[model samples]
Target: MSFFAGIKAKWNAKMDKVLKIGDFDKQLTEIIADGVVTNNELETIKRLIQEYGLTEKDLNIVGVKAFRAAFKAMMSDNIITQQEESDLLAIKDILCVQNELVTKEMAVLLEHQELRNIQNGILPVIETGGILLQRDEQVHFLLDCSLREERVVRRSYQGGSQGVSVRVAKGVSFRVGQHKGRMVSERDVVVVDTGNLAVTNKRIMFLGSQKSFDVIYKQLIGYQVYSNGLDVHTSTGKTRQIIFDNKQFKADVLQLILDRVTIQ
Candidate 1:
């Protein structure tokens, strides 16, 4: 018999022998140190719990610790495989863990998976509620973003006199040949709309409250990645950008743009 099996046999043979809760927790900690909780280990834990008269509630602390260890182990490489995800979900089912964390982590993991799928050419045309997609196009990232673009506004300083003039009399002034009044055509960055910024296999699309655009990969001249957003340039003489203020999928979006989109 194996070591744990032999220990179980001996403990079973001794009728008066009992296992302590702390000892059980320590054993569980050791088992989860490798970031994997095997089926046999789980079974052994269940049997030990029954044999020692310990409730699942009593093991809550150790269970959460084990789950966290497994989660960290999966995240150490920055990618959560299907098996690792399965392991975490299993642990969550067995333990009373925080639901919010699992939900958020699962979402991020799904996004990671979608990005991978895009790279592998196994894309899916998912149904998005806020925007419409063309046939055979797949969206890898769709997020709420604020659209900002350069606009020409003939700006003029109005609080004070900005006209070039010459003093002719005590209280009256003679204006110069042509007083432009400080008005000039200058481009200013302004938030024009709120919308969904979507990166797809074929194009980058923006469906906004006040505007919408679709720029195909062939039209892309260049792109820029920021700490919180992305900007794409097209060859159509018009440039626009959107700010999402989120860092979660920035890398994935950048990778997608770099991979399929042709930069001129």
Candidate 2:
């Protein structure tokens, strides 16, 4: 068996034992590592077959250079984000433990991205191209070339009391109304029996300062204000309100949202 095949064989056996013991977190971590290994191995196999005209015999010759070149291409094309690169490098560390050819220095270099280390470094160019995966105090970024900030505006229809929602991206939709869009504004209000309404915490926190706004709005639920020529209040600490004023930005966000929301 090849190195990966051998690893899989052992992994499967270990999985059986772990399942019996029910070490879920450990098992999940192993599964994620295995998935990365499988994906990389499949990619390597595809390249070898299409370009080098090699067979199974060449698996032993697979080196870090091939992986590095493929990864570099993906980065240039914006296929994978920096966090993904870090995950792949972590997988490589595990792989290196099994193979003597994979070196420590190379793994470190692969894991590190100077551009990602500094905030606002890559934002100006690809602001709407990524997702910030929150983990503890650190942020893990992932890019979705299919969606952009200008194309993810949140919209609330004129006559709806069902709260606001974001427009969906083309070819990407989850449920009936779970489309990913930008936050515009939110407010808190009290409904009385005499057809009177009291509005509070009206606030607008654009996409750029979303995290900070979310933090502050969670505590300012009683204040009210105007947003996009409409009156509203920041009533809920759970949901975010977003709006886009720029014509082109609104147009793009609406088109992408409609593309995802239209009934098939």
Candidate 3:
């Protein structure tokens, strides 16, 4: 009906023909059947891509479905082991050779799996909090305000009336009694100066006092390390700089981010 849709349908038809001739679909099924894409399998895939003159779009059309099947096979046990993660990464890397878009799709799948790991409490996390602000799940803290602070405010008020006597025109006198009232109020305010940062299998999340942020591994474009903190750059043209009390944690965090990014 639409121009792009028509093109896509034509492309899919062409790819279907190519796939059948090369038996690419069957080969892909065999490769991922064991939840691992062996070297021989990878070589065969590369050969098929070359022999069929398959473009990145063609690979994407085929690879995504095949990757999903492989992932499901890997997750059939309801748990993803370190070995399984490694195997998935290997398969994703070979797919990346076909197109950059493949990298993004793989990252999303991996991130979803990693998110599941975090939800299951199987992923390790670093808990620290002095969080002043949060955007989404991304937490922000001031380096100088790494320590928590609390303050209390108190207020008091009192009112009183003295007794009085009044005489009316009819020579009647009336006396009024006085009363007093007092009130006090107190409120406690708390400020957070640290937050927990977790690098799960798929994304980086900062849990802060006021807010939190989640930056998926795919969205992270780059990072700059500083003596006191690090600045994370994302594909959305935003940078988040975080300060940690312990400088060593910066290295650990950077490594974790790189590990997640490199796999895809």
Candidate 4:
């Protein structure tokens, strides 16, 4: 037998001995009443299942109450931490409640926790392009290349009181030059190679290009969706536009930005 099977057989044997005492419901209720299932409580539950030869139906009978109690404990503080979310999901799986109504209910909480992790930069967000760059301890949401499109960018520079003001037909860039004994500024046109976009819980990042920039989530004012791409507006009044080959990608990216930015 496999390791798990062997363990199951051992638990089943233990359970058979325990069933003779006939306190399964009482023991299960006691374990679940605290609204949290600790390691010992989980072991006890496993033993009860093994002893009673509990099938899915019997498991759900006990599981529904335990799931609710565990979920309530996690939500008691009005915020579910990553550990709590993981634990609850594990409990749901172990209780064989995967098909229960409570499973769907807990999914919302799990999704919220996932989004929360992304927003807090506790997760790594990644998008595939010509290259992939990732690090530990970062949240990366990868929007596939099916959603990316290329666009031509043009730029121009004009001298002003503030300095040389450079503007791009697409995004923004800066260039330094000397004119008439003063620092003359000119608009620097950016040439991007193998560009892709990614949104993390903390920021929106452009990757694999010289003009790559990371815009923090807090600085994002809003985004507009176009048939081919998306336009992201920052708090600085600058807008970055990205065109995707897929229209659905445009919509999905827009919705992702809206969902992420609104929560923060």
Top candidate when judged by lDDT against the true structure = 1
How good is model 3 by TM-score? 0.36
Per-residue CA lDDT of model 1 for 1-264, tens digit only, reads 899999988888554333466787677678667777778876776777677666666666566776777677778888776677777777766655666746666676677677666566655455677666677766766778889988885666544444578988899987766533444577888899988888777788888878988888888887887767777888987778778765554666466545654432
> All models: lDDT?
0.71, 0.35, 0.61, 0.62
Query: Which stretches of candidate 3 lie above 4 Å from their native place?
Result: 1-16, 19-23, 26-57, 68-80, 97-148, 153-183, 192-264
Off by over 4 Å in 2: 1-60, 78-80, 94-112, 120-264
Q: What is the lDDT of candidate 3?
A: 0.61
lDDT of 4 at 186: 44
The TM-score values for the models, in the order shown, are: 0.64, 0.19, 0.36, 0.41
| 85: Cα error in model 3, Å | 2.2
lDDT of 4 by residue, 165-210 (tens): 5676668766455353344344433333446666655667776544
Ranking by lDDT: 1, 4, 3, 2
**How much is the lDDT of residue 141 in candidate 1?**
62
What TM-score does candidate 4 reach? 0.41
> lDDT score of model 4?
0.62
Q: Lowest summed lDDT over 10 consecutive residues: which window, candidate 2?
A: 140-149
Query: Candidate 1: minimum summed lDDT over ten consecutive residues — where?
Result: 255-264
